[model samples]
Every structure is written in C-alpha cells, then in structure tokens.
Target chain A: MAVEKFLVEASHIMMFARSVGDANQIYYDADYAKTTEPGTIIAPPTFAQSSAQFDPDYFLRPKIGEPWFGSGKEPTGIKRESSGGGGGGGGGLHAEQHFEYHRHLHPGDVLSATVKPGKTWEKESKRAGKLVFSESITEYRDQHGELVITARGVGVRTERPVDSK
Target chain B: MALKASNLRVGDTHSVCIVEDLKRTQIVQYAGSSGDYNPLHTDEIFTVKVAGYPSVFAHGMLTMGMTGRMLTDYVGDGRLTKYGVRFTNQVWPGDTLQATTTVEEVADGIVKLKVETTNQNGVSVLSGYAEARVD
Candidate 1:
C-alpha cells in the first residue's frame, strides 16, 4: 500500500502499544520518556504496519458507501462470489513479515510509504492445502525524505481455511 | 538501557509472558489501531459462517507486535535495527502467549536474536529473528 502521508502522533502510538498489551511508559508518557534513551515517546517495532490507517484505499477497512465483507444483517455485508476455498475463504492471511528500521518513529514524524511487489510462489501444506504466497516490499520515508523503515510482507491464500490445531 | 555487547553471550535468552488469557477486545483494539479490520480477526459470524473458522482469531501482526514488546523490553527502547517473524499458527482467544528471545550472536556493536512465541498449548504461534544495536 502506498501512503502519501502517515502521521505519527503520540495518542495513536499509545493505543497501538495498548493493543499489543505493551505498558511501557515510554510509549505513552512523554515525561517518563525523557528519562529513557530515545528521549521521547517512540513507536513500537511493528508500528510501521499501521501505515494502513493512512492508505485511503486499504480494502480491509469498510468505506462509507461500500459493501464490506464482514458480517452485518445476514452474517456478511456482501455476497460471497464463491465459497470453495479453505477457512479464510481465500481472503488471504499474513504469512510472514520483516522490518528493517533505519530509525525509530516518534510523534510529529510524517512518513510516506511506497510499495513494490516482490515475489509470488506456491507451496503445499498438510494443514492448509495449496498455499499461494505473494510478497510486497514497502519503503517508509520520513518527511525529510530519509528512508525510515523497510518492510517486507507475505500474504497467502490457502486452498481451504487452515485447520486450527 | 541498551544491551551491552560485553555482557551478552550467544546462548543468552530472555522470555516474557506477552499476554495472559488473550481477549477478543484486545484483538479489536489492534484492528482499530492497525487498520487491519479483516473479518477473520474480529467478526465472529463472518469468521464462522462465512470464513469457516471456529471463531475469530488474533491477527498475526498482533502476535508479532506483542512479541516485539518482549524484544524491546529486553534490548531497551529504540535499539532495534531489524525485527521479523513468520506466523506459524493462529492465535485464539483465551490463549496465553509466551515470547522468547535468544542471543544468537554478538559482534561489532550488534546483537542478533532468535525470537519465538508460543501459546499455552506449547504450539508455536510465531517465530523469527531480530538484530539490535548494543553498547
């Protein structure tokens, strides 16, 4: 996903930290952060993935007038084109993710992300059937045009929903 | 508070109970913050009737994110240079997770770490590696 502007703010970082159950004061309390090495509230290691919030066309999020895939009145807001695949209904699942941080993120940092398709491959698995994996690489650049983080993500569509063991 | 290369060893390991009794609400919180509102992670009806899962599950990134906390808490804030993970199994509600990091190497002011997170059932949910700067 290409995000022209991902605004990093303190409150969002705080909530992101809380979601992962991280209670480190350095993520929320600026005063306490001053006593730390970074000298300010810094985003968590995986916080770069939150750039989805700034991507206006991210499909996972429902738009104002669009038909979403999630449940509503009829167990789903949209009609299923086909229900032949395994568990996630071929909705795709996160397979792997890697991040290279040139620098940590902090409040007031405005970043932009550019995505480049990486590779596509297929694999067979006992628990999930045929797995189709595709990768994408995103480069996050700060307002000053310095590359901040390099992220590689792999998404897979299984032949069937993976068996929860 | 960064890790000192002088005190690190190849076999040194640190582990933390990342989450206890994982809750659906926390999953929702992650979806809201990360903007990954995939139905399989939040909507139980869609997940069960449509997606064909037993119930909603946690996002893989959520597990990675939580596991990341264990790394930062051990290596200290803003010290990470690289962190990555592969989702091995789905994380579900009520599953307590433990994340562990083992020092694989220390050299030239950098420490390489092997990371893994497992559910209470002793099944690995995520596994990967990380590298960080050291004193």
Candidate 2:
C-alpha cells in the first residue's frame, strides 16, 4: 500500500460528483449546502477513493505494463520480471469497494490517505478459475489530523484475463 | 426526508436515486474526473475486440457512486458511517438504474440498511449495505 495526501476542494468535489452524473446539489452548490447542517459542500461517498488520480503513488495505480481499459486488442508488451512467483504482474480488476465515514468531508479539508493491504482470499469462479482477490484500504484524514473516511477496495487478478470472444 | 436513527424500522424503504439513462460519455466523464484511465469502460474497440466483450461497460465505481446517491440523499452530507457495494453485473449503455434502500436494523442510535441498485431489467448490478448514526 502507498500513502499520499491531498487537499480537498469544492471544485474537485463538484467535478467528481458531476463526472459520475450525480445531481445532488449539496455536492456542487455551496450556497445550498450552507443551508444544511454541514454548512458547506461535502463529497459524495467514495469520492476520495475515486479521486486517487490526485495521488500519483496510489496503491491502485494501474501496473506499468498491465492491460488498460482503452488499449488495443494486442496484449500489452510490458513484461513482469521472473523474480516474483507468488505475486503476479500488474493486471487486475476492481472487485469490490467499502467506505466508512468517521466524519463529514467538506471543501478545504486537507486529507491524507495511507493505502494498506487488507484481507486476501482465493475462490473458484466460473468466469476466471482460481481467482485471487486482495483488498486495499485507503484512510483519509483531515488537516486537524482526524480521520474522515476509510476507503477499502478489492482487486481481483487472474493469471490471464478472460476472453469474452 | 432525512431519516433519523430513532425512526428506522425493518422494511422501511427509502427511494433514493434514479439514473434515467446511462450515457457512454458519462462513463468517459467519470473516468476523466476520477483519474481512472481504464479503457475497458470507454474504449469500444479495445473492449469489444481485444477483451472479447459484446460492448464497453460502465465503471463499477460509476455505478457505485450513483447507487450511493441514495444514502447521501437520505442522510445528507457526513451522516453516513459506512457504505459499500459489490459489483454483480455489467451495466451497459441505455440501461436505467434505480437505487433503493431498506432499514434492516436499528438500535443504539445506529441504523443499518440493506442497499440495492438494479437496472431496468430487474437484474441486480450492485448490492451492499450501510450503517449510519441517526440523530
């Protein structure tokens, strides 16, 4: 797991919400949100985790040579070193997500996230046989050094991705 | 209506969010905003030909976030203690999604909910739950 920090802002919060096609005004309208108990715009659930792009070293960063969603039919030419046996290469898919809110997040909250490895399990799957799953938990705290939210996500990796064709 | 923990009861239902229809560009927008460059969600050529899927699909997070609108809308900002989702199916373009929640438990000023989001076809795409302290 990788640890990185970020300063949450109203604009970023609004963008993430809008990007998801969310119509909640509290996420975008500070004036409207001010009328609410929170008194300021707040991020929607999993906003910090979904905004991992702001943190470069995020644990869930796509592997260097792994297959990306937008790539061609050809396999990525990147090679994983043979030194690793148990841990496979960089290709994996997001399997599940969890978020625990310790407190509300508002604009101007300087959040720092520490991504840690969580539970690992193996199961037989009809789609991908003997699938391996790993969890990554990212904890976000505010500027006052208080926990705001803990985001737990799962990634499933297959030795070779399934062929839909 | 904001639901207080005291008011929670099993079978209490909350109508949350309705994604009238999904748009391909919306998925692209989400990927751009979230900084996820996964082509499987947006690259039709890559997804259909390279990945062997019938078509590109929505990002799981995109669906999760949309489903989360139910909790956030009901409880408002910062009231939710925990929320999570399990991806169950592919959400394709032209699909309509509705997120709904049911009160499963209530005690100690904490409310537990059984959350579900399904497409127009009545097929569940995401399922999970949440816990929030009601005031």
Candidate 3:
C-alpha cells in the first residue's frame, strides 16, 4: 500500500500564525522574519500540525470495509472490495501522538508531508474485544528538502461484536 | 529575570499568570488560521447541539500556544529545546485561564516543567509537561 502525500503553502501557515495571535514578524512580515529569525521566518511551534487542509474523505477517512474509522468515528458497513478486511468487524480509536521538530519552519518554505503506517500490533480489550494497535508517522520536509518535523500518531482498531454490551 | 536551572527544584512553582476574558474573535482567528473547523471550537450552535458543550471553545493548540508564549517570555526564544503537551480539557470564551508551571526534573541543560492551565473555579482545563534547555 502506498501512502498519500500532501503539499501546504505559506498562506496556510500564515493563516494559522495569525489565528494563534502570533505577532512574531517571522510568520507575517517576511522581511522582518528574515531579519529577526535565523531561518526564513520561523513558523509558530504548533503551526505545522495546525492549518492542514487535508481532504478527510480521501486523506483521513479510512477505506470502506477497513474495519475501522480514522480517529474517533465508529466503523461503517462500507467495504473497499480491494483491500480485504483481515478478520472480525470492529473500529479504530485514537490513542496518542508525538511530534519532533528539527528546526523552525519559515514562510515560502513549501512543506510536503507523507503519512504512512509505522507499526501495528494485536491486543485484547476487556470492553472492546480484539484490538489492533497501529502507529502512523507523518514526516514533513521544507522546500530546501530538510526534515522540519516528524509526527507519530497511534490508533487502535477493535474486532468486537458491535452489539456486545 | 532569567530562570536558572539549578535554582529550580522538584515541586518549585511559579506565580499564577492569568489571561483575562478570552474572546470569540480569538477562537475564530484560531479556527481560520489552523484549518481546524471542528465546530466544537467555532460554531456556537453546533457546539451546543452536536457536542453538548455550553459554548464555543478555544482550540487546544491555541491554549498550548499561550503556554509556549509564557515559557518564551520567561526563558526567551531558541531556549525551548523540547516542548510537548497533552490536551486534557476544553476552554470556553470569557473564561480567565490561570497558568502555572512546576519544575519536575532538571539535568544536563534541560529542565522538565509540568505546566497546567485552570479556569476561575480552579478546575484544570489543560495539563501537560514540557522540557526546556536552559543555559
């Protein structure tokens, strides 16, 4: 399976920067940012993960019959037909997320992020039935092609009876 | 005043910093900028009816940004080597958020801080920890 990639522009970054009330010249004032911060104009710390305009239907929404939803939603009956559901039906749950910043991101630094599965393991939940835990890693790179940030997010999919109480 | 790593001990606390009367405009700005249109954060009707929240709330990242600003204000830029947080609760408009930081660990040019934000009633809104590299 191939992981999808997305591109984000400076406008998106600036929008999030403004939303956070970040007055740092680096985010808005390009000249000021260049002069103030060592990099082009350092992006606010949380900016990278913030203003993402991903199409949930394609990028985030899980494939039909995948036996799980993306973050918090329950599994629907739709099936991919292409990718086979491994076993009993269940759903996915968001577990945790971690991010590592290499250096400050700046305006005009086109960013490309790729999200892919990092790891998966099986576990049993007393309440939710059999669960498959997985981690997705999204790596971001700047226009200069440097690794700016790396984010790893964990999710759990359960294979429990839907009507089980 | 610079915060010295050696001066900070486990259980050491900082003065309460209050951000008075957060407004809806700030929340809107955060939503517009962050692309997080999770109505629980912006649309009042949606938040109330769908999410069952009392009112529109601020984005978790916005609250974290405020905390980051506080750390930067105290320690200066480029000094925050490692910062991380977990969103524990939500914050609504007109609420005054009081922030506090407690030194949890210090070693090798790094100081671990347990940061928390609370509402007027002293109920915690956000609680997490961060580590900063101090000179």
Candidate 4:
C-alpha cells in the first residue's frame, strides 16, 4: 500500500492514545510535554499503523458506494461463496508485526508510506488447519523525505475457523 | 524517565496490566482510530454467523497498541528504537491482559528486551522483542 500523504495531527494522536488506554501526558498534553525529554507531544509507538487512514485503497475501511463485508440487515452485507476460514473472524489474521523506528513522530509531521511485499509461506496447525502467511514491509517517510519508521507485518489465512480451545 | 544503563541488569523486568476486561467499545474505538474496520472486530453477528468465531474479537494491532503503552511507560517516551510481536492467541472482549518486558541485554547505550503479553488465564497472546536507547 502506498499512501501519498498522512497528516499527523495532535488530536488524532490523542484519540489513538486514548483508544490504546495510554494516559501519558506526552501523548496528549503539549504543555506538559514541553518540560519533558522530547520537549513536545509525541505519537505513540504503534500510531504509524493508522497510516491506513490515508491509504485510498485500504480494503478494511468501508468506502462510499461500496458494499461492506460486515452485517447490515442480514448476518453479512456481502455474500460468501463458501464458509470457514478466518479463525478469529476476518478474511485473514495478523500473525506477526514488527517496527523499527528511525525517529519518533510528533504532531504536524506530514508523512508518506511505501510498501513492498516480502515473503509467503505455509504451515499446518492442529488448532487452525493449514495456515498460509504472507508478509509486507512498509517504509514511512516524513515530509522531508527522511525515513521515519519501517514496519513489517505478516498475515495468515487459515483453511477453517481456528478452534478456540 | 529513561532507563539508566548503569542501574540496569540483564534480568531486570517490568510488568503492567495493559487492559482489564477488554471491552468491545474499546475495540470499536481502536477500529475507528486505526481505520481497520474489519467486521471480525466489531460486527458480532457477521463474526459469529459468517466468520464462525465465538464472538467479535480485538484486532491484533489493538493488543499490540495496548502493550505498547506498557513499553513506553517503562522505557520512557520516544526511547524505543525497535518493537515487534507475534500474535499467539486471539484476544476477546472481557479478557484481561498483562504485558511484561525483561531486559535481555544492555550495551552500547542500547537495551534489548524480551516482551510478552498474556491473558488472565496465563495464556501467552503475544511475544516478541524490543530494543531501546537508554541513558
């Protein structure tokens, strides 16, 4: 996925920090932040994942005039040709995630993300059946064209719903 | 405050209760902010009837995000240079989570850590490692 522009604003960081239950002043209180080490409000560690908000073609978000996969009047808004798969309730599950921070983000940083597909592999599991995992690596760059963070994620598609036990 | 290398030990550990009784509302909040509106996270009917899960579950990123709070609180804000994790189990609503980080190594002004998050039942849900700059 390529996102041309991701505006990192203070409110978004505050909301993201709240959603994750982080109460750190550096994440929300700019006044308090000025006295701290960073000397400014900083984004949370995992905040860069929200770059999906700027991805025009991000499939997980419902686009206008597009039929979503979630429920409407019925159990699902879209029809499925077959059942099963999606262990914890989606097309695929996040198997792994990794991030390397060249620099942390603060409000007002305009960023962009470029993605590269990494690897694909398969594994058999007793609880989830056959699992196919694919990886993607994303590089986030600030407006200055400096690489800010590198993210690697692996997604797994299971043959059937995973056994909860 | 940032960790001082001189005061750190290889096995020094810090733990925090990341979330208690994880709520679906919080999951929705994460979905809204993260822009990952996957039905498996907030749409219980579709998740139960179509996707065949017991119920809607938390996004792996949500768990990671919450765990990140623990990391930053321990290592100090903006101190982390690397953080990564593998989802080992599903996190459902009503589950309490605890995250722990152990110092694995500290050298050259950087500290390496072993990170693990577990559910109330002591089942490991996420496991990984992190590296951070220290004072």
Candidate 5:
C-alpha cells in the first residue's frame, strides 16, 4: 500500500484548540505565546492525535470485508483465538497512546504527517477472550523540515458479536 | 548540572493540581474551533445513541493540555527537557481533572516522572509517564 501524506494547516490548529476548551492565551493569542515560556503559542501536545482529518475509511473503517459489519465503525484488528475464532465480543478497545514533542508547533506552522503501520500481533485475554493488537505511528514535521511531534498508539481489537443487551 | 539517579525515588509524589470545572459551551467552542466533530464529544444525542456516552465530553487533547500546564508550573521556562504522555480514558464536561506527578528515576540531570489524571470518582482518566531535564 502507498503511504498517504497529509498536511495539517493553521486553521486546524485553531480548531483543535477550540475543541479542547483550551483558553490558554498562548494557543489563541499570539502575543501571549510569544511571551510565554515556549516562546510561541504552541499546540497542545495531544492536539495532533485529535485532528480526525485522515481518510478514516482506508485504515480505520471497520469490518472492511465482513458483510454484517456496520458503517462508521471499523474492526479493531484484534481477534480472540489464535485460530482466529471468537471468545468474547466487542471488536476492540483502546490500549495505549504515546507522544513525543521536539518543538512547539505554532499557528501558521504547516505540519506534514506520514502514518505507517508499526506492529501487529495477537494476545490471550482472560476476560475479553483472545485479542488482536495493532499499532500505528504518525510523525509530524514542520515546514522547515524540523521534527515537530511523534505519536504511537495501540488499539486492541477482537472478533465478537455486537453487544445488544 | 546532572540530575543524579538518587534524586528521584519511586514514592515521591507532587502536590495535586485541581482544574476548574469546564462548561459545556467551552467544549462546544472547542469543537467548532478544532474541527474534531466526533459527535461523542460535541453532540449529546449522538454520544448517547452512537457512542453510549452519558453526555458531550471534553476532547482528550484538552485534558492533555492541562497536563502541560502542570509541567510548565514545575520546571519553569528553558528548563523542560523532555515530555510525553499516553491517553487512557475519556473526560466529560463538568468533570474535574486532578493531575499528580511522582518522581520515578533521575539520572544525569534527567528526571523521570509518572503522571496521571483522575476524575472525582477516583477513576483514572489519563495515565502515562514523562521525563524531563533540569538546567
């Protein structure tokens, strides 16, 4: 598969700041950020993860090949048994998130992000049954070709009937 | 200039910082500004019907920002060496986030700390660790 590259614009930064209810003068007010410790209104560390502007269908859309799969949802890529059989339901659960910041990303700082598959494997679960674990890492770079941020996240997925009760 | 490994112990914990209760409007404004239209975070009905959430919730990044505030307070300017975190759970409006830090290991002027944020119910909303260097 070809790697998809995306550009994160300044407006996105403002929007992320708004979504998080971050009223910090640094993020919204340029003057404040310039005077602040980071020396610029820098993006909140987790802001990049919340952008949600990626092509969700490609990597995140659930049950790509399953007929009974629902819309707006994607399989967590986690399966129960080593033979790929089921144990308990619920496709996947959030496992962990890790972020590293090199420099403060400010307004008007265009960021280019390239996401790639990091790892995939299976694990035995005591309660939720067997699980599939997938991880992806997205690296963001500024227009100046400087590293801005790096994020690695894991999603635990399983094959189970949708919960109705 | 170097933070010795003995500087931080496993049991060393910092004072807790209590964030003021954020309003629904603040969350909504964030939705409009950030472009993260995940209904689970901005729309009450969508949250209940689709995501099974109680109500509109704050963005995870918002909670992370609060953690950043804690760092700024501790290290001051030009002193922060390295910072990182992992998002563990969701944070809803009206939820108060309390952040606490504990020294884990300090070696060669670098301080490693475990950081966490929890809600009033004592449920951990975000759990992760961080490392910083002091000048």
Candidate 6:
C-alpha cells in the first residue's frame, strides 16, 4: 500500500545527519551550505526519508500486534535446517539495499512512500542453515507530487528461530 | 558543485572522499534516531557473545550513509535519481572509510555515476552507483 509521510521539520534532516555523527558543515551551518558548491542544505544520500522501514504504516507491519520480522502466525514455507555455521548464514541480517533519487530532498518535504511487495525467495546457507530473502520496494514523492526517490531493500533471515543462548 | 550535466561524459571523474572515522558512541546515537536497535550493531556483548561475532560493528546503512555524504559533498544539492550499494564487509570501530565517484554516462539531462566505498585496508565495504541531475 502507498502511504504518505511528512518530514515534520527541516530539522529532521539535520538530526539524521547528526545522528550519523557526521559533522559535515554542509548538513549543519545553513549559511555555509548556501555559500558552498550546492548552495543549500540538503538531505544526505540514504537520508532518513529514503527508508520505508521506518514508516509506521509500512507493509511488513502486521495490522494486528507488535511488529515482528517473521510470519505473524507460524513459520511454514521457510525451509528448516539444523546444521552449524559455515556459510555466513544467520537468522538476522540486512543483505542488501539500493536507493534511487529523482531529485534532492529538502527539509519539510511531505513525501509519500508506497511500499509494494517485491520478489522473495529462499536459498541454502552454510552458517545459518537456510536463508529467506525478500525485498520491499518503495517510491517517494515530494509535496508537489513528483516522484523524488525510489528505495529497494533486501531482507535476509535465518531458517532457525531467534533464540537466546 | 555538481558538474553541469553537459559537462559529464562517460569517463568523467570526481575526486575521492575520506570520511571521518566511526566512533563507538555514534552507533548508539544512530540507533536512537534511526530507530533501528539491531543488537548486532549497538550491543557489544550481544555482538561478541550472543551473535558469536568478534566485536560490535557499524550498520551497513551507516557506511552507506557516509557514502551518501560523499555524494552530497560532491554534487552539492544535485538530485540523485538512483543510489544503491551491496554491503560487502563490516566497518569496525576506528576504521576510516573513503569513496570516489566516476561519471558513467550522460543523456537526456541525467548524469550517471559509479561510487565505491572502502576501508583503511583498502577492503571494499560498499560499492554502487547513483544518477542525479546536475544541469
């Protein structure tokens, strides 16, 4: 489903930049950014808005209870294996990610990010037993209703359930 | 400043960027603001003992975000049409990452770029490309 999200404040961009612990003057001093090469403060690449996973109404979120990574009811289709480590396979891993920007994002851009279900599959793994792979595709449109960014992410989970040892 | 779209050719090159070293505390702050509390990244004990890893590591997105810094610093407010990277390796504390971009193509007012990020050992942590409007 396509959902809309507001930037809330231009400061969100700065906060994200600071959170990353990057003291790049451009992300901070607005006047410096204004006089510099780009001539304006702009969101860093992979800015907070580029992530649909952060959206409260994202698709992976089940309508019922607290958000969980695996299936809500039970794990059925996922292959199960009890082998030990060797293939770097693990229950929890962020396998891959990609982001495409149609335009730069400014603070306060009311962006709508629509997360559409993407291709998912399973493969064998040596370390984590079996690995399930999935992607959630999202498109971000700015306040003017122009597509500004497209984000794609790959999620990987181990066949074994998360446990404490 | 980003080069004019017209000035970008397939072989045009942007200088390399050396990012600040990753500190221990930034990991926690990032988790707080980004709302991603993956223990593998934030909890030292979890990473070393629970996860059976050597030590706590920075999020790939954090490195990717620093790579994003390279893009923004170079393009200066230019629009990025596409930016993506595969997390090839982990960035440990005290590792200083660096990245560089090359113009791959220019057409229809779009400048295509290839970006690569590497660690102090010259080991690649992430690699990808991006397209942005510079004209």
* The candidate that achieves the highest DockQ relative to the unseen native structure: 1
Instruction: Tell me the docking grade of candidate 4.
Output: high
> Candidate 3: where are CA atoms >4 Å away?
A1-15, A24-40, A54-97, A117-136, A152-165, B1-18
lDDT (Cα atoms) of all candidates against the true structure: 0.93, 0.74, 0.60, 0.93, 0.59, 0.67
lDDT string for model 3 (A1-165, tens) is 222334555666677766655555555666665554254656666666652555344332334565332123322223323232222222233444455668656555666777788889887766556767788787887767788787765655545321211
For candidate 2, the docking band is medium
- Rank candidates, DockQ, best first: 1, 4, 2, 6, 5, 3
DockQ of all candidate complexes: 0.86, 0.50, 0.22, 0.82, 0.27, 0.31
- Model 3 chain A lowest lDDT segment of ten: A82-91
lDDT of 3 by residue, B1-135 (tens): 346776778898774554678889888777666655544455665444433345666766788776666665555444555566654555779878878888888889888888888887787766767666766
Residue-level error in angstroms, candidate 4, position A46: 0.3
Model 1: residue B27 alpha-carbon error in angstroms: 0.5
Q: For each candidate, give its TM-score against the true structure.
A: 0.98, 0.86, 0.66, 0.98, 0.67, 0.75
lDDT for each residue of candidate 1 in A82-128, tens digit (9 for 90 to 100):
75556754358999999999999999999999999999999999998
Give the winner by lDDT: 3 or 4.
4
Task: Identify the CAPRI category of the predicted complex in candidate 5.
Answer: acceptable
Q: Give the per-residue lDDT digits (tens) of candidate 4, residues B26-125.
A: 9999999999999999999998998888999999999999999999999998999999999999999999999999999999999999999999999999
Question: What is the fnat of model 6 with respect to the true interface contacts?
Answer: 0.40
Candidate 1 vs candidate 5, TM-score winner: 1
| Residue B108 miss distance in model 5 (angstroms) | 2.9
- Per-residue accuracy of model 2 over B39-69 as CA lDDT, tens digit each: 6677776556555566777878898888887
Candidate 2's residue-wise lDDT over A62-101, tens digit each?
6576543344445332343443211113346677998888
For model 1 chain B, give the 10-residue run with minimal summed lDDT: B44-53
